[model samples]
Target: MADIGAAIATRMDVLPITRTHRRATVAVGLGLFFEFYEVFLAGVLSSVLVKEFALSKAALPPLLASTFVGMFLGALLLGRLADRFGRRGAFLLNLGFYSVFSLLGAFSPNAVMLLVTRFFAGLGLGAEPPLADTYLTDLLPARHRGRFIALAYTLAFCGVPVVGFLAKGITEGKILGIPGWRWMFVLGALGAVVVFALRRGLPESPRWLQAVGRTEEADRVVAAFEAEAGITEQKPAAAAPVNEPAVPPRALLRPPYRRRTGMMVVFHLLQTFGYYGFGTLVPLVLTAKGYPVSQSLLFTAVTYLGYPLGSALSLPVVERFERKFLVIGTGLAMAVFGIAFGYSGSMALVLVFGFLYTATSNVFSNAFHIYQAEIFPTSVRSTAASGTYSLSRLATAAMPFVLVPLLEGAGPNWLFVTVAAAMVVVAVDVAALGPRTTGRALEAVNTDGAPVTAPERAPRQ
Candidate 1:
């Protein structure tokens, strides 16, 4: 009898995008919308709390850093959880965990409690990106993976500006007499619950099912999708064996994977400081330059409009471009724009540069988010991706601690200099060591299994 991995590859590799696939992608992305929305809330929320409670400089970094502390721990510890557990279950767990804690955060009595709640909530946020990315990477068709991944992230990233507008509305007027800042968390919590319920209908990955010896279940999943799409069952690819051996997380550092792992770790650490460094400081940056709170927030919202638009712009080109080079080029653009924004003395210059920074970074964001999860095989994919990804969260956690001081001591220009230099290193590392992954199967690119490159013409059942 043919084995499960071959069956899965045959089923998944060339299947046309079905309604179910679109729904699955959207379901995953919707939950992510809240996660990212909450992440960006730190910027607006900090402003709200500082004004309302007179939050101190010392306290601010800790509060901000606390989320990443929880996220780092989550990513470090939970990396293997999804691998050990099922992807669908683990993802729902992450979302449910975050939803509950995010709601609880709204009722926090003080910044300490708020910090604690955000930290707890972050435990889920940290685990999610890798889990979601890995989940999509494993499930998506290799031929159209680039475009689909970009679309999913584009939908998720729409949350950035959506949250920006929400914050602006809440700050302007309270709903139910609750503060706008608190409502931000409440909305995020509510949205997540809805997404979780919608995702309950999603099928488990056939690859994951096969990995855990649930080959029959894997077959059923493939059959179900095929039935829904009116696709005839085809013979499994007569190539790779059903299952590859699982690697311990440490083994990822052994040979072929070691260089990629190192590259990812360095990329995450460097980019976090640059991306989150500027992201978390937008409101603060504006206020420091003497803009009124209303004007600053308005400008912030205007600038953030680039987030979704940039991702959308990347959609047409996502599949066309080599992912590594896309990441490098956009990252460099992000740095250049970021550096210019920092040195900008006038409002017009600030908004212009900020818009460029947000747009380019997002294009970079969608590309690398797909790339990182693409390089590894299924067995230890989440563990390796999450473990390496956690470093970025840790670096982001550390950014407030590093950046607040730099901005206070050396001012915006020097602060951005630090950020740009870090981004430059990330670009150089990827350009130097990144693998060629555009238009290749995950198995072929990873070098662990037989190459199952899709033919130019679509295979008929």
Candidate 2:
């Protein structure tokens, strides 16, 4: 049963990319789109937040940091729920969490209430992405895994400009007698609700079902996939070895996986100080450069053009490029452009460097998100990814506290220098420790150069 289960899982992967796959990808991607759209709202509503809440500079960073704290908790605590239960259920649970809280945030009477809602929203936000990637990775073939995941997130990146444009348009608004920023949250919440409804019908991952020893159900799901694609399953070879026990999460700290866990810990923690530190701080930096709020919103909108474009352009080569190299290369690109962005004296330079930074950073983002989920086995994929992913959430949770003070004392250039230095360390860590996963079989990638197989396991409670 384990041998046939592995073969069925692999067969689903190698099949032609189908409408079912695309539909699932779009459904999954839409969830992230709304997540990124709302997340980037921090940049979008920076001025509005300051004005509407009468928030002092000191009051704002804590508000900003609260979301990541919720995210940190969500990822660390809820990540394993996907592995223990099911990806579809876990996704719907968290997406509903972010959606409801985001709408609740819009109704907040003051900053503190808004902060509380944002923190709760962040919990769902943090839990969704890695699990979302894990879901997609489980469904995709090794050959097309990188491309589909990159393209899926390319859809998410499109939200950057959507929020930027929406923010610019609503900057001076009293829609329904409420302010523009509140309306912004309303819009994001609405988008998430729609995605959540659409996602209700998605099939659970066949691999996850197989991993849990539900061979009959796994075969049923894969049969539906084959019927959709009009293909037949080929004969599977002999069984391969897999650790049969449903090892505890602590097993990740044991020998073989411990190094991968350590690599991700280093990568995610430092990488956040660079990505979120600069991204969320961009609007503030522009304002400090003497641009009025309106112009800053305008320039920020333009800078976001790179987000979708870079992710889209990377799709063709996603499979061709080695993921670790892409991760290392793009991380370096982000550092270089981020440094240039800090030094820009004119709007033109800011736009140039900002655009470049967004593009490369997204390339890095897509590569790393996929890479993180790829390293772990099915039994703990979401748990491991979410666990390590919490590092970024925790780091970003503190980013505003650390970054704002630096920007005030050392100026933007020095702030960027600090960010670039962190990314440099990330690049080194990946180049030195990241695994090679390009075009390799999931079974091969899991065992790290050993034969891949589904191990027999007793039913998980």
Candidate 3:
């Protein structure tokens, strides 16, 4: 099994980018697209719902927090299925789970029902990203792993702007007498279905197969990739001795992993304040500043263009810089831009800083997502990543209850000041404790789930 696993890892690590790789990345990315669509939709859709549902200020927090709460449960519960079973099956199951409940949410008659459905939808949505991070890290070659992962998320983040613009238009009018916000739910459900179909052909992670002692399947899958890359004519290289023994999930709390796990937990806990904290509150902040709902949603749509654009911009630099430095630099940038955004009175300054703030967030986002998955071993990659990721969900889930009151009482500047402080904590946490993963193979990063000694650094551009 060790030999087989080593062989599988070697073949995958050395292969050039190929059509097979792109197909798999796209399949995973499409699911992420819809997951984020539903997640971000809450902010815009909830703003309209405050009026449409005749929601009391008291009811608003529960409605907004429902999705993240469900996600919290989903990541904690369902995320392990990928590591315990296989990545491909979990991929299909999660999307199907989210689509059904989200469709039901479109027809929800009252706040309670909508909240319930969104929670269930979130259960499925929560696991999608951690699963994506695990699967992409397992599948992509180390040579340009960060670049390809960014490409996957570049496609994924497009969902953010799509939801924003769709909300801009859809919230204004009815489609077939169904309220526009409800239509957003219907559209997310439908798009997820399409991605479900598109993902049916995605191959299981070969590394996972080898890890679970399914060596024959692992070989066949790697062989197919080798053929696709037109490298089958060459002799197989001697397998390196695999040190990646099956480490139990509990190992994350012991020794070398304890520090890594602690770093990620703090990072996830604080980072959301910078990312989703700002994202979810932007419309409300604009509204507080006296922009009407229409203008708020419009400005949100324009600023959100940064999500995909920032992800695209990261592709060139993601591979060039060390992941930890990228994460640290972007966190500081988000704090600066977020403060600028909060202080701006002019519409022009608001748009410019809002766009910059959002763009920097995505770069921050891309760097950390890639960083998280790479830090763990294959046996517990999904478990560890999802476990930490669940913390982010929990933070975002509680964000409305905490930040909403702050926004109301302290004003947008102080609201942003809170977010900036959190980002600073994230920068410090990652800088002090995060490991170097740039271009290193997983086995080298964490040997037998223990901390690895310094490995060769990725060559600089």
For each candidate in turn, the TM-score is 0.95, 0.95, 0.96
Q: Which tens-of-lDDT digit does each residue in 124-160 have in candidate 3?
A: 8888888999999998887678998898899999999
Instruction: In model 1, state the lDDT of residue 17.
Output: 78
- When sorted by TM-score, best at the front, the candidate numbers are 3, 1, 2
lDDT of 1 by residue, 1-461 (tens): 23456556557766777788898889888877887897888886677787666887888888888888888888876778888887888888888888999999999988889999999999987878888888888888887888888888889888988877777777766778877788888888999899989989898888777777688898888778777767774654545433345566777888878999999999999998777777778888888888987888888888888888888888888788899999999988888898899889999998899998998888998899899998887878888889999999999888888888888888888888888898889999999888878777776777655454642323445
Candidate closest to the true structure, highest lDDT: 3
Model 1 poorest ten-residue lDDT run: 450-459
* Model 1 CA lDDT for position 413: 87
Q: Lowest-scoring 10 consecutive residues by lDDT in candidate 2?
A: 452-461
Where does model 3 exceed 4 Å of error?
A: 233-242, 448-461
- Give the per-residue lDDT digits (tens) of candidate 2, residues 241-285: 333234568889997889899999999999997777777888889
CA displacement after TM-score superposition, residue 225 of candidate 3 (Å): 0.6
In candidate 3, what residue range of length 10 has the lowest lDDT sum? 452-461
* Highest-scoring model, TM-score: 3
Question: Which pairs clash in model 3?
Answer: none
Enumerate clash totals for all models, in the order shown.
Answer: 0, 0, 0
